[model samples]
Target: MKRYWKYIRPYLGAFILAPILMLTEVFGEILLPRLTSMIINNGVLERNEAYIVKMGIIMVLIAVIMAIGGIGAAYYSAKASISFSTDLRKDVFHKVQEFSFKNIDDFSTGSLVTRLTNDIQQIQNVVMLTLRMMFRAPGMLIGGLIMAYLMNRQLVSILLVVIPVLVILIAIILVVAFPRFEVMQKKIDRLNSGVQEALTNVRVIKSFVRETHEEEKFKTTNRDLKEGSLNAMKVVITAMPLMMLMMNITTIAVVWYGGNLIIAGRMPVGDLTAFTIYIVQILMSLMMLSMVFLQASRAMASLKRVKEVLDTEIDLTDEQASEKSAQIAAGKVEFKNVCFQYTKGTEDLVLDHINFTANPGETIGIIGATGSGKTSLVQLIPRLYDADEGEVLVDGINVKDYSIRNLREGVGMVLQKNVLFSGTIEENLRWGNETAGMDEIILMSESAQAHGFITSFKDGYDTDLGQGGSNVSGGQKQRLCIARTLLKKPKILILDDSTSAVDTATEARIRQSFTTTLKNTTKFIIAQRIGSVEYADKIIVLDEGKIAGIGTHQELMETCEAYQEIYYSQKDREKEAGA
Candidate 1:
């Protein structure tokens, strides 16, 4: 709660003013009943027309004042609450943006989305109610009780018994309902997860003819959510009626006892009437108090969830970078006895004591079977995940020594899974180099072998792609991704199986363009096809977590057993296909 004060501080004036104005409305309500009692005794019963009209005018003035105060309270409360929630949501989103890969792994996407949207909304509602009702309810209750005692001290004794009973009931409701609200939030998270997954994988679900299975899975989560909500609400549903029953019973006792007092000449009819109104005021205020407490209990749970995101320590930072660190002007990279594990403190090593070097302007090919840590190895180049044990160097300086922004800017990586957001082709390309112009975009597209197909579209560069480039073929999407990376014109380019979707002929053309045009850029290509890396300056054969061999393609084919086995398998498959 203290952490969130910054958002509310800017609206402090509105926050303070709302409750103060609401108090005026409470005062008016308390005074109105007393004015009614005076009009009944001194004006109506005495048959004084002048007195009745004067008291009636006073009642009208009080009502007008209460209306104005209520409107002011509402306006200020709404302004403060809405602005606070907007700022809080923005901060939560910014914190999410700062999260490292490891940080994101700690919270699911669905859970984060729920916290941002629904949880913040819950807190907003509670804050608005706090400003408007938290003070007014208590003020009205106390004022009405005092006025009732002044009217007839004996008649108010009935409330002493009923108020204690209502307090006990509210306490019991809190004890039973708090834990259920927490569980209900978790159920909401599960429902959101199921919906998100089903939507994202709709194509796969349809192709597998699993609509019935998906429907059943959704039904299970939806039913759980419904049950949880019902259980949480059951406490409120039961408590409200019990409270009303107690209120009605207390009103009956007040009427029966007060009527006898009036008939016996011990009490005035006006005092009895005012005492009844005060009883209603006190009981209604207690009900409002219980409702506010219930809302606040749920909001406490939401506050904790939002605080979790804000407080998580980012795992990766660039605090150690200095001004004097060497720039990666020429693409040169090396790994020295590097060992890494995705899970910290785990004995399992994904890359074990691997050592390799690539000089400026050299093209290197890395080959291995699946799960040989191919993607993990290249990720270290840009410091996406730091190597657990050894140094990763760029431009002959430790990668850690350079600022993260500077280091990543010098290295362009086309990840294994290519993604394009919804936008014109030109807009997506600008993400790589914001300042890129028409000629530069056309040049990079041509180099990537994507220009020929792009021009076929009626809109050309202005063509809009669907989410994740769903409208394009796998090959076209891959080429467009490569073209986007080319716009960066980094010193080092890492293509991790980015060409696997394209045919061998188109792949050959792309590599040829890279060789001729990007002569000074160091390139690292990870591929399963031997033919893809046959013309490389060097080839690395990895077996398990170790580097089995590194040499020119012909040299590796002759001297490395792992390389020889892979080559023969590909040759045999090619011969069978040809036959």
Candidate 2:
């Protein structure tokens, strides 16, 4: 509640004004029934035509006042609720942006999306309803009961039996409905995940001829969501019928009891007429109050889900760093007896006791079998994941000492999976350096060997890319990503199997450009083909998470058995002319 004050404070005037305005309607309704009794008893019985006309004119004025209050109340509630939701959604989005990779793993992408959109919408509806009915319903109930009791106390006693029964039933329904809503929300998360996965990989599903299998899988998730929603709604269905039954039964009982009194001459006909209207008003007020509670039950579940994201403790931050202002310089990287696992407390290590060093301006090539922790080793330098048991140092300082933004900006990585946004080619490249000039952008593209194809397009650099660069070929996408990273001109550059899709000739030219354009930049290239790293200044051969060899290509073939096996197995052995 204290946390929500920021969102509510700005709209406090509208929040307070909505309920106050609703009171005018409550006063108008209560006064209307009593005025009707005056018209019948005083004006009609005495045959005073003048009095009847005066009362009619007064009643019309009160009705006009009620309409104004009702509209004003609606305007203020809308003003408050919409503004509140907008600010709340912004804060939730900003909190998500602060999440570390590990923090994001705690919740599914679908769940976060649902929380940001659907959950907040539910709470907004409740806010509007609560403002309109918070005081209006209770005011109607008390006013109606008082007027009815004054008209004839005996007739009002019928409500004692009906109100308690309806209250008990509503309480029971609310308790049963809450857990069902929680389950329904979880079902929505699964359905969203299924839809996102299927659409994102539509091409793969088509190529593999798995459309039928995917359709069946989606149907199963959709059916589960349908069942869960129906299960929750069953409580609402049961509740409405019971409330209507009690209301009708009480209304009939009141009229029947009051009719006997009228015939016996114990109660006036005008008083009985007004009393019946009051009975209906009291029952309707009870219904409005019950509805408020019902919507609130669902909103409570959403509130908890939203709070979970805000309360998450990020595993990575510069909060405790002694040197938060430290920057990466010279690009000398070292891993001292590093040990890491994806899951903490697990004995199965991804990189076990890894030790390595790359001097400034050196070209370090890492080659190994699949799942040899090649990607894991380079990721540590950027502080993407902290090593579980050792230190990763950059420029003679612990990587943790530097802020995450500063550390990552200093090390540019062209990931194995190339991703591009739905924008012009120039826009995607600008993500590396937002202030880079057009001339600098073109120079990097030329170095990456992407300028040739880009210029051949009719729109050149202004050509719009589809989602994830879907309009481009795999080889072209790889070069664009390389060009984007090159625009940063970082002290340390990593190519993680980035050129695997390009032709050998183009790859060689791209490598050659690096010598002149980035002569002082430290480069780490992880490759599957030995030819890619054969001419490197230093080559590290990895076998099962441990470094098997560390030297130039020629030195590794002479001494390291693991390196000799890889060298003899590859087509590079042919290129070396039967070395």
Candidate 3:
């Protein structure tokens, strides 16, 4: 919470002015009851109409002043709080953007989203309440006590008993409620995860006719959240009733004792009247202070969650890079005894002692079974995750020597899971090269065998795509993704099973275009089908985490056991289908 003050310091003027204005209201409140007492004693009892009228006018003026001060205080406190939240949210978002894939994996997507939205909102509300109540509540409590004691110290004796009990109750509530709120927040995170997962896989759920199962899962999560929230609120709600009971008892005691003093002529009726108002003020202030403490406790949990993201050190920053390159003039890649694992110190390595090389303008093919580290291997080139041991080199220089932006810009990759945004075709294409001209875009589309279908659309390149390219066929989405990458004109291009949805004829044409248009670019094609990579200059076969074979398709078929097994199995499946 103290660390977050940098965001608040800029709004210090508003913070300062809000409490100062609230002081005016607090003083007016204290003065108003005394003025009423004066009217009851000197003006009404003595039948002094002139004194009554004068004091009444003064009371009206003070009321107006209190009204203005309260309004100003509310305005400034809101300004300070809202602005503080806005800056804090922006900072949290920027910090998330800097997170490496490993860093992101440390927290679930739902947890991060909750911290950004719900948790930040909780903190904002607490800040606003604190600004309004922090000074006003304490001042009112202290000032009310001073005024009550001055009027007649005898009436103040009741507070001695009530204050200690109220303090103890508040302390107990904080002790019990703090941990409950923390647990409740974790429950909210789980609830959010349930909702996010259900929405993201709604299509799968519907296709499988599992709507009832999904509903049950959601109900279970919702019930847990409900129960946790109730448990936390029970602690809070219990305090309110107990505080009010104590307050009523104190009021009754004050009146009973003050009445005896008034009748004995030891205390004036007016003094007794003023004493009651001060007592009410004192009790109400304590109640407000207790409520403030409860809110602060809840906000403490959210602050800790938010601080976790802000304090996370980005693992993939370019600060360690000692050199920068303007462009990847040549696409030559090599891996030397590389080993990597998703989790550090894990026994299972995703890629084990991997060694491979691709020369400028060469076409390389990667073939492997599922979970064979194909994607993990390509990701290392872009520095998405650094190798746990050994080295990855591009253009004869160690990859870690180059800045991440420069490294990634030079390598264009079309991932296995192609994604398209909700926008016009041109907009999605421009993500690869924002300054690309219309001719360049069309040429890349044609090379990727996407131009014909795109031109057939009524709006041509202006056609809008649905979210995740839901409106287009899988083949079309893959081609569009390929064209998008081609527009970058990168020195190295990687397609990770990107053409799987396309027919072999279309795939062949796309490959032919790659040979002609991307003659100078080194290319890597990772495919499950032998036909897709049979024409490549060299194909590498991966078994488990190690390279099983590396050669031309003919050489691999002759010399590699793993390659022979995959080729014959695929050939047998095709023959069975053909028959």
Candidate 4:
């Protein structure tokens, strides 16, 4: 919570001004009762009509002042709270973006979304309430007690007893409810996760006809959240009623004792009336204070949740040493005895001591059985995850020596999972190079075999794509993703089974375009289809985490048993189709 104050610092003027206005408003409220008592005892009791009119006008003037103070406080508090929340949300978003893949994996996507949206909202509400009520409530509670005592100390004795009991009740509620609020937030995170998963995989659920099963899963999570919320509410509800009973009992004692005092000529009737109003104000103030603590407890829980993400140190940071390495020519990659494991104490290595190199203008193909570490090997070149041992070099320098932006810019990759945003075809293409002209977009789209379909649309380049490119076919989405990568015209292009969705004719055309249009760019192709890599300058076959063979397709077919098996399997499938 203290860490979040950096965002509030910019709006300090508003934060300070609001409390000042609120204090003035509380002063006005405290003064009004005293004025009422004077009017009753001096003017009304004497039946002086002139005095009554004068007091009435004074009361109206005070009321107007109070209204102005309230408005000023509200305006300042609202401005500060909203500005603080906006800055906080933006900071959290940027921090999340800077997080490494490992850091991102530590928190689920849905949980991050919850922290960004729901958790921030909870904190903002608490800040707003605190600004508006925190100072006012305390002033009212203390001021009301002092006024009541001064009016008639004999009746004020009830408060000394009542206040302690109310404090104890609030303390007990906080002790029990604070822990539950934290648990309730966790339950909300789980519920959000369930909803996000259902929405992301809605198509799979429909295809499997598992709507009923999904609904049951969602209901179970929803019920957990409901139970947690209700339990917290029940505790809060129990405390409020008990608090009201205590306040009412105190009020009754004050009235009964004061009436006897007035009858016995020990106290004035006007004083007794003022004392009752003071007692009511004190109780209301205490109630407001109790509610503030309750809300603050919940906000504390949300604050901790948001801080977790913000405090996460980015595992990958640009190194000063990387600056000298950027001067080297791009597309010179080297893997020297590289090894990797996702977690500590894991015996399995995703990539073993593998040595390889691909120079400028050269194409390298990686062929492997499922789980053979092909993707993991390439991921190291960009420093997505540092190798546990050995070095990954780009442009003849250790990748860690290059700035993250420079390293990524030099190497453009089309991931195995093709992703497209909700935008026009041209807008998606611009993601690769924001300043790319229309001619560049057309040339790149055509090279990736996506231009034809894009032009086929009524709006051509301006056609809006649905979220995740749901409006297009899988093949079209893959081509659009490829074109997006091509627009960058990166020095080293990595295609991780990017052409798997396209037909053989389209795939061949893309390959031809790469040889022609992308003559200067070094390409790393990871493909399961043997035909996809047959034309590569060199093909490396991976078995488990080690390199089984490294050569052209014809060389691997004859020299490597694993490669021979893959070749024969592909040939056999083609023969069956021919027959």
Who wins the TM-score comparison? Answer: 4
Regions of model 3 farther than 4 Å from truth: 455-458
lDDT tens digits, residue span 78-163, model 3 = 99999999999999999998888899999998899999998999899898999999789998999999999888887898899899
What is candidate 4's lDDT per residue for 1-579, written digit by digit as tens?
Answer: 477679888999999988888887899879888888888898889898888899899889988988888999999999988888889999999999998888988998878888888888888888888998978989999999889988888888889888888889888888888889889988888999999889877988999999999999999999999999998788888978987898888889999999999999998888888898889889988888888888888888888899899889898888556474473355888889989988856989888899988889888999999999999888888778889999888777888888888888888899999999988888899999999989988999999999999999999999999778878998999999999999988888999999999999999999999988789888999999999999899898998999999998888878999999999999999999999
Task: Tell me each candidate's TM-score.
Answer: 0.95, 0.95, 0.96, 0.97
Clash-forming residue pairs, model 1: none
Query: Considering lDDT, where higher is better, how would the candidates rank from best to worst?
Result: 3, 1, 2, 4
Model 1 misplaced regions, further than 4 Å: 323-327
lDDT tens digits by residue: candidate 1, 123-220: 99999998999678899889999999888888788999999999998988888888888888888988898999898778889999999999999999
> What is candidate 1's TM-score against the reference?
0.95
lDDT of each: 0.90, 0.90, 0.92, 0.88
Residues 1-579 of candidate 2: C-alpha lDDT, one tens digit per residue: 999999999999999999999999999989999999899999998899999999999999999999999999999999999999999999999999988777888999889988998889988999999999988999999999999988888987898778888789879888998898888888998988889889878989999999999999999999999999999999888888878888889889988998999899998778888888898899889888888888888888888888888898888888877777887779999989999888888778889898888998899999999998899888888877889988998898898888888889899999989999999999999988889999999999999999999999999999999888888999999999999999999899999999999988998999999999888898999998887888888998888888998999999989889888887788665767666
Candidate whose lDDT is highest:
3
Q: Candidate 3, residue 477: CA error in Å?
A: 2.2
| Cα shift from native, residue 475, model 2 (Å) | 1.9
